[model samples]
Target chain A: NAGVTQTPKFRILKIGQSMTLQCAQDMNHNYMYWYRQDPGMGLKLIYYSVGAGITDKGEVPNGYNVSRSTTEDFPLRLELAAPSQTSVYFCASSYSFAGQGSSYEQYFGPGTRLTVT
Target chain B: EDQVTQSPEALRLQEGESSSLNCSYTVSGLRGLFWYRQDPGKGPEFLFTLYSAGEEKEKERLKATLTKKESFLHITAPKPEDSATYLCAVLPYGGATNKLIFGTGTLLAVQP
Candidate 1:
């Protein structure tokens, strides 16, 4: 099973151009997340969804938006891309069972490298 | 606020060398600590998860131990294939959804 898949493994964007990074998981996970990893920095959450049609802002949500229209897909949108947004993006998902004690071990997809010029 | 810090930002070891990578963390309340291995140009791969102090988990040549305020990933008889950046993350208690705070990670290079 393709645990998680991301589109456009690499991309070059011009400043102020907008783009959307696609992420899909076949694990039937209920929780999905988007994170950006800068050089020598830890992954920073951009957005996440609990389930279909439910999305929430994370630590670094500015300049980014997300939508979870289906259980298997969560997409991150950059309305106005900036050089600061140049980083490696990762998509991850995990399944949570009620009363099972928080076991949020996430499965990540190959990251998408974005460079803003 | 929850935070994680890893020591020796980078390490280089020859095959058969044994070493330990440290992950120190601070959180309101700890729920779980995780270890992941990430190769260049790829996303992190889950390695081990520690739930409480004194809890330890092992896989192949790697062992992870957890304490009240820190976690340690011990590597024994490492091989070149074991080279990767090891990441540590933590899930805090009292969150509606489990969100993890991560460390900068320890990059390990195992030379044969």
Candidate 2:
């Protein structure tokens, strides 16, 4: 199903540069998320959307922006990158059944590795 | 605050050795606990989801057990192919969004 896909497998940017990490899923999931995994820090949510045209901030949202213009795409933008932004970024998607107490499990994409120098 | 922590940060064992990895957590109310396997340079693959205390799930040689306060991933007769970082995550009750809190993960290295 090509479950989830992300672009720019690896990137290096000078401080103050800008870039966007592209993510897409073909699972017809209603929920999509962006997370960054720093060494030894696990994965932290950067942003998420419940459906197309809806986006919200997560635990660590600063220095990042996201837009969900289509059901299959969620892109993360770095307006002005900083060294602290260096990390591995992952995109995940899942479908939740209505009236269910628990959300469905998420499937992840091979992450994008970004380096800010 | 909701939090998840995994123990031994890293482990190494002979191909046939059996061991367990621990995931301790703190949350207002538990909804579900999850386990995932991640290989180098790849995204995490979902393993199991435990909904309540005493819940257990198994796949191949790995078994996951959940409790009121923690979860465990036990590896039985491991193989080199089983070497990877094992991650634990939780979904707390009352969270409108299905955001999961993840642990740093326990890196497992199985030697043949």
Candidate 3:
């Protein structure tokens, strides 16, 4: 299994720019998530999808958006990006959607490092 | 509020030395506690998952034990390959919502 794959391993964006970080999984997972990690800090959730056609905001969802139109893809959209948005972004998925009652383990992707100037 | 904290911030051990890392957490409900290893510039690799207090899991030289309020990862006669940042995370009750709250992590360096 390819597990989780994220596109654009690295990117540099100017203030006010817009971009989308793509995340895909081949394990046929029903749960997918987006998280950001800053230097010397733990990860903060940005958004997540329970399954195709369902998305929800997480701890830190400001200035970002997400779409889960298909089961295999959960893309994060950054609109009018700022320096505060710069961080190492990770995409993760799990075999099952624990549905507000489960604690299934999640598998992660290598990540995408983005810098906003 | 649910929070996870890892102690010793960092540790340096000789190849034959034995040591344990700590993870203290506070959550209304714990679905599960997780352990992960992360190498520099790479994503975290899953290690073990502990579902209940008094539960334990082992892999190679690493052993993870869990309690209601904390968890411990004991490294026995660790090798240089064990040098990596160890992260602890929690799956809070009420969801497999794909969200895992993580600690800053403990950086362990095993010298040969």
Interface RMSD of each: 0.6, 0.5, 1.1
lDDT of 1 by residue, A70-107 (tens): 99999999988899999999999988867866478999
Pairs in clash, predicted candidate 3: A100-B94, A100-B95
Which lDDT tens digits does candidate 2 get at residues B2-54?
Answer: 99999989999999999999999999998889999999999999999999999
Model 1, residue A48: C-alpha shift (Å):
0.6
Interface root-mean-square deviation of model 2 in angstroms is 0.5
Candidate 3 lDDT tens digits, B1-112: 8899999899999999999999999999988899999998889899999999999999999999999899999999999999999999998877546468899999999999
TM-score (C-alpha, index-matched) for candidate 3: 0.95
Name the best candidate (by TM-score): 1
Global fold similarity of model 2 (TM-score): 0.97
Which scores higher on TM-score, 1 or 3? 1
Tens-place lDDT digits, model 1, residues B50-88: 889999999999999999999999999999999999999
Pairs of colliding residues, candidate 1? none
Any idea what lDDT model 3 has?
0.91
Candidate 3 residue A47 C-alpha distance from true site, Å: 0.1
TM-score of chain B of each: 0.98, 0.98, 0.97
Model 3 off-target regions past 4 Å?
A: A97-103, B95-98
**Which one is best on DockQ?**
2
